[model samples]
Target: MTSPLSSSPAWKALLAHRDALAGATAADHWQASPERGAAFTFPCAGLVVDFSKQPVAPETLALLCALARERQVPESIEKLFTGEPVNVTEGRPALHMALRGDEHAKVDGVDIRVEIQREREHFRAFVEAVRDGRWKGATGKAISAVVAIGIGGSASGPQLVLRALAPDHEGPQVRFAANIDPAELDQALAGLDPATTLLVVVSKTFTTEETMANALAARAWLEAALGPAALAHHVVAATSRPDRAIAWGLPECNVFGFAEWIGGRFSLWSSAGMPIALGLGMAAFDHLLAGAHAADLEFRSTPLERNVPALMALIGLWNRDALGAPHHVMLPYAARLEGLVLYLQQLEMESNGKRVTTTGEPLDRPTVPAIWGAPGTTGQHSFHQWLHQGTEAFACDFIVVAKAMGSDPDRHARLLAHALAQSEAFMDGLDVPDAHKACPGGRATTTIVLPSLDAMHLGALIALYEHKVYAQACLWGINAFDQFGVELGKTLAGRILPAVRGENAALTPATHHLLGIIHKLAQSD
Candidate 1:
């Protein structure tokens, strides 16, 4: 695992630029110099990225571009698109891109297009059956609602997509329960007919604690009303654990499996995307994949300086390391993209939130910042105050669809107005003589404008973030594929569960005292 950064001319150039940045201050440059913007070119998925707002100089941009070139980023992008093994730690090709239209990509001389087509056919059939009255519950009722149960990637992707594309939905209403909280499950199932609801359990392994717990709770609610036989009618699973699902009373036919090579966050193009497919239909799903593939083509063919993903990655590194920013915000103005912030939080943080690199060496640079954000109008009412007046220099993204999906013309105008207004405010702050009232005008912000809020644009938006994460991982010299950080908490929970159940032997004095207090409090309640 030789690092792409170490033995390359690009690395040397970047090092030189980094050194050059020390003497420059925010006071010296309030606006991004034209020379800086001219030094970088942007390319991706029919989207034009403007990275001129970043603090990087022309020399720095050239250095970053050289680093990307030295790292064989173009070749790596091609490898990823063609199903080569880029996920080194996992020893698998991250071929989520193949789930899109990879007609030219072949595995062992077998075209991936056929498999994708077959899977889509299966999805369409299932969706049509459910959408029409052809697929009936045991009680002979049409499904009026859907509950998607899963944690992390399984939950985040579909949940975000559904929320963003809600205006286009014409089928059953969909709800999601991903947390381990009983309250979330209770609320999701509340007022839903047991015989008229479908529960789509999504986990690569059908054994995720939160997903299974929520599934079982939903099952119990259904059985309490519709009887045990209703399990077959109410439950469907998107997982490789078909045996487990069958053993748990789900029909084998109801189990859908995706390949192990597809990471959860990237699995939306696979069967894990069934919920989204059902909500939006096969045409929209294909459009989503097509948009991603479009970006994939751009990323693979474009040069480093002209690469949108690479430039986005370099700008992020500049903000985090050079500009001393500790946070990155994803603020989409469209209410439909409300869940996008949460999706990106997991995608970026869980992928790169590491202290060590791929080969067990401690990283000298910061890995990931606190990735947090919300939708526009709501965020404006809440945390926009801190974002505007706060001392900390947080890097922010303002995402807006050029045109509103909503039919209300006045509402759409207001939405776009707020979107444009916020970015303007961030770039040119309010002025007051008093220190408390004075606003910092030089705060950095990036605006991502989409053509529209259709499935294609949303797909492109997500793919952009995905590629940006990949490029950043390459720059930081870490494996973005594996997530060992999530394992430690699972291990700790196993040890604590027995104690929680009062089945453990001698406890530590502190634990025993806490147990006594808990028991007393329980009795009092």
Candidate 2:
């Protein structure tokens, strides 16, 4: 595969082709055919994705697919699924697909299927024991609340899943603490009895400072209230480093480990999602995995045009490369899916926000757009103003559910209508007489309409985006797995800790000055 540069033959063709398409608009495409929506739509894992609002002609779609082929996307995808070391810098395979409960997945001669299933069963038994009052704390009190401690993907993914599937919860109330700030953990523990609280500590290495601090603090709180033995009964871990967990005084049986092959952003499908299983029950969790597996199968087998992930990737590439969009926005109309944007923001930005290509050469093209968004109705009042008439261009995705769970029919109908209205308004902006009222209405959006918000659909939705990120990474020749960009901060923070405490001579002038101000403020306090 060749580097995807402006000078490449395929990219040059696309550049010339885009010039010819300069006059084309979303409105023009919509008006070209009444069946335009149907023509551009694809169904996968029970979600119907409508991409008609995107300004792409049939020829353009073909050319995009050709570009993908030119970049060897198919070969890349095979490497992704077959556990090749696609994460070249780290020399690890991004085999998150194995976490979706596939019974036949093998990576590096190890049957990941057996391992995943074993962990699933272990998770199920533990959840059942806790929920059924068989597993009690040191005080013999039934666990009533679970404090999930982790940061970033570890915390956000399960938090999102637990919140979305709360109705299916037959277990303890799940609370989340992701921040390094002590207040976050304190707030989560508020109103919950230490004797009845089980802390779930999650980190791949079991050494993330924020998570470990929160875990140890929670342990102290529990031990203070329930005695030292409470640590054994009240704390469990989801980690890839069981030896470290055991050394930290956690019982061997209480430590659940997943493969190191799972990236933190993609670890939710593994035992890192234990909190989700505990909150949503194993059945709902299974549905989530099954839904993702279904989407994965489709992504692996379907053609570029027919594949939902492929089309989404191509549209995203088109928006970035051809239309010159600098940002991507997500809007989920369902209130239950409020965390969707946060989850995807990390998934997209952390995965593909790279300046270099896979071959160690600097990339000349943009990788990922600045991904951001919030839930609808509330967002309608907040950032929708900028989305409507803002000067910057955006490639937006509006996710809606046809039948909302527990919502009144009229209210659900209104929600659906508002979602469609927003998409239409973006595509066909108001051409009113007043300058302020005019919406320069050619902004592109893709609407994802699900049958309803359920574990299955949510799983499929997340997996679709995962595959889409992979497809886009292939086109850009970047590794979507390794995240070296985030490590520098942690490294710097460790070196700065001593400076922040007192010493300023060893630090840079700017950092020393900042630390001096912080120390001065602290002494005043």
Candidate 3:
């Protein structure tokens, strides 16, 4: 029986080929072809993707494509677009695409597109009311600030949107609080009047520990400034379980219900994205969806050979498996993309960093490289040292926007120059005389060029990575939608909470000792 994937003929061929390219350097490949830059770069949906500096030869790409064919990548793409229940463990189709207008998906023998539109209309009404002062605070004041309270995708998507698109859009003073730490909520709520503040609590289950904790705290803070009656007008929830949200002391009208197929990380496209509409205008949110839909079409219609998302997945797989790089870094030259790395950490790692296959068999290979990074030229000062001279080499993606944030052409030109120079430096290093200054630059890097940073561009950028993660899971034979790995930590934290409160709950010796010290410190305080 074929147990591990390594036993497959295609997997074996890729493995054999991995060893043959062991001695080659990225510099050698960069010099191997005159058309390397033109041949390796591809454009789709107004974004340019350059994979020329990925430490792979044309032969390696051909072999990777052959492996993709052998692994049925085209079939996987069809399965995803056709609304198959690819997320087998949950017995549900990951129809987040339906929220973006995938016409062919049906949930429970009923068309979900109509339901998605209904939900969107329902939430859009609420957003319009808040934006227009029709939905006033309990004290009859129009809200000027909106504090989005959610953990993970719920907060990250909205925060990233507000930060990236803040220059172009004029909306509410949007802020996000995700950590259970009191300081985080304290800072988010600091100096804001509760009468002019609107709270959006997002959770799929209405029961996420961190989310609910912050939600309750924010409610209490708002109640202290206003009254208990203020919660009806001051707070709203975006969740699948609207009944539970209403029961948790929100008005029924305040709860925006979504379908169950929306995974937390992918829910940004669903009603969980209501905060995006609230933070930006409904028009910006609509543009975000339109941009994502365009990418969805690009991924759906383009063949694997020319598909941008497909090529990203295949190249990522080659870097992770064949080239043996364990870390991938994101370096966006645009300051607006500051949160892009954190967004991708949860998007890629939470989705594909799995140990077992879909059928519950152990995987013989690493699933995902550790996804982490910072915005550049900032990262150039911080982690670029490690990227250039560290003993371990990593895969990097340099995201550069052609247009600057403001009208300062000189600063933007310098930023663009530094971005290109870094890529070149990474590809072709200086063979200097001084040993301390010598930099061995054989790192694999990809340059993704965006015309500008906007809601539409952000939408396409996010969708590209989302599909890439899903395709990587398909290639690895793992369930990308299910994230059972995060449960154990949550469970342990639940049991440990009582210990922190000075209760005699069960605990390991190490934990008990730690709790003792914690209690002693609290007593001193």
lDDT of each residue in 272-297, candidate 3, tens digit only: 88768877888999888888888888
Global CA lDDT of candidate 1, please?
0.78
Per-candidate TM equals 0.91, 0.97, 0.97
Candidate 3 error regions (>4 Å)? 1-3
Q: Write the per-residue lDDT of candidate 2 for residues 352-421, one digit (tens) a residue.
A: 9999888888888888999998888789999999999999988999998888667479888887888889
Arrange candidates by lDDT, highest first: which order? 2, 3, 1
Model 3 lDDT, full chain set: 0.85
Best by TM-score: 2
Q: lDDT, candidate 1, residue 249?
A: 89
Return the TM-score for candidate 1, rounded to 2 decimals.
0.91
Question: Cα miss at 463, model 2 (Å)?
Answer: 0.4
Model 3 scores worst on lDDT over the 10 consecutive residues at 1-10
Stretches of candidate 2 off by over 4 Å are 503-505
Backbone clashes in model 2:
0
Distance from true location, Cα of 228 in model 2, Å = 2.1
